[model samples]
Target: MIHQVQRSTQVGRTTHSPKRRVTPIYAPGRRHPVGQVVGDAFIKHIAFSKHTLRSPRAIAFDVSTLDDAERAGAVVAEIHDTESRNVWTAPIALIRSKGFPVRRGFGNQWALTLEHWSRNGLQSEAEAREEQQAAKQAAASVVQLGLFGGGL
Candidate 1:
């Protein structure tokens, strides 16, 4: 013969603190992303340098909007010059990272512009007048007037 017994154990109840609500840091825009605005600005600065015939020694970027626990991107570049050095700082927006191709292409075009300026040393007012006169003369020589007074 076996006897059956029932046993009960008391358990304590634990209360947890309420969860804190987190608010979003950034809002979305048509051209700008919620957090990538800084990146865009930084890239734009780079592109500007490329096109504007400007050489900056250093560039510092601010990325406050995109600063998150998971990821925070930043940009800091230094360009060394033999004679002297200069520093430039700007914020990096998210839009620039996403639109890298467009930014890069624009930068390339800017670089070409700078190169042309560097090579030609930028024509002076007098030099421009001379060039215009030469171009006009060349055009005039290429075109001939026919008997009916029509350009051929």
Candidate 2:
């Protein structure tokens, strides 16, 4: 004869909830828009230009240190045009004495100014030399023009 015993079993069930999504939050502060930043830069440039023009003596000293003649002349011209109605003749003379070829053209002027900065330890010597060479080449390429005659 075989005897059978009955066993009781209990099962537990758990319910799970889905995770929620979150949005990014930003702090409140003055946001500098791109246009505003550009406008500020423009205003600063204008102010600096005005200040440079007001101080012709300083401008002369600054230009005198530059090695390029054209650049120096350009600086003088810029000062005269932007800062003062009267010409800054003294600065022009100072620039001419520095072996810079007095001439027209934006590049020539920039080269002269950069040369000055280079000579004064403000710029690397190599850079200054390069600018000088470029300016020289530019000047050499220009056809000579007399007071009355056109380009020769």
Candidate 3:
């Protein structure tokens, strides 16, 4: 009697219910997502390109982090492109720095400004040049200190 009453009380379904779409990254102070960037810092945003909107960038899926898909400071990202599709185990930093902005998505909350991207590019280039200069100076010192190599 209870089983029949329970079934009868349920007035039947009107439409199909869909599951809520969960995003991988979220604003700070919120519940942590499944994919954690490194330790506690979540992946704030992702950008890929040579610092321009025209450049090609990898598409990042809101994927959950797998146990074997991570290294010290990198993660295995699935690369999907027009030419070819391959798996790239790149540093997390690179992935975020090069990611491009999407016209539409979860919203600006998931995207970084183009200015930030430009600045990052410039900073990395500057660091590279500085390292080269340091290396050259070191080589010159090595040569100067060689046997009978001190000033003529």
Candidate 4:
């Protein structure tokens, strides 16, 4: 039970009260429609460019967080652009940040933002993974020195 303290009209007096729980009024599932068009009217007024839409071919927002995918912090979204006869893949974040409303099915706004990034030329997932791996390897190869000023 949730409670709130209310100040009484009489000075130096208060009462403990329970607040009523409010339920959602909308259909539980209509929360976040994936790729649901934001429309030209809305996009045009925004700060970002609308005319320079992300390459339809390169916008693959992969949503996965299993094993290596989680370790790498992103997953490969292999989007096949049939009209262009080209396949493009981009990395989308696994753990999302705050602010974007959590969707009903898809979970949160991270994937949606990733989709926007993919449309605006985010790097390929494969390349990002490769770079991350290389960085790890380089860090591991570094020699650690002892506090005594000699290799222990």
| lDDT (Cα, 0-100) at 125 in candidate 3 | 44
Order the candidate numbers by TM-score, best to worst.
3, 4, 2, 1
Model 4 agreement with the true structure over 1-152: per-residue lDDT tens digits: 11122332333454644443221111124452222111111011111232112433122112321122333222333333434434333333322331133333533322333332333356645457778999987665554334446553
* lDDT, each prediction: 0.30, 0.30, 0.36, 0.31
Please, what are the lDDT tens digits per residue for candidate 3 over residues 37-57? 333223333333421233232
Q: After superposition, how far is residue 21 of candidate 4 from its true place, in Å?
A: 43
Name every residue pair that clashes in candidate 4. 54-119
Count of clashes in candidate 4: 1
Q: Stretches of candidate 1 above 4 Å error?
A: 1-110, 118-121, 124-138, 146-152
Instruction: Give the residue spans of candidate 3 off by over 4 A.
Output: 1-52, 55-74, 85-89, 96-106, 109-138, 147-152
Model 3: residue 2 alpha-carbon error in angstroms? 38
Candidates 3 and 4: which is better by lDDT?
Answer: 3
Q: In model 2, which residue pairs have backbone atoms overlapping below 3 Å?
A: 66-116, 67-116, 68-112, 69-100, 71-109
- The digit string of per-residue lDDT tens for model 1 on 1-152 reads 11112333234563544333222223222233222212212112224343233342222222333233113223422222223333222222322332122233322211111111111134434446778999998777656444447766
TM-score of 3: 0.26
Between prediction 1 and prediction 4, which has the larger TM-score?
A: 4
Model 3, poorest ten-residue lDDT window?
1-10
Supply candidate 3's per-residue lDDT for 76: 31
- Measured against the true structure, the TM-scores of the candidates, in listed sequence, are 0.18, 0.18, 0.26, 0.24
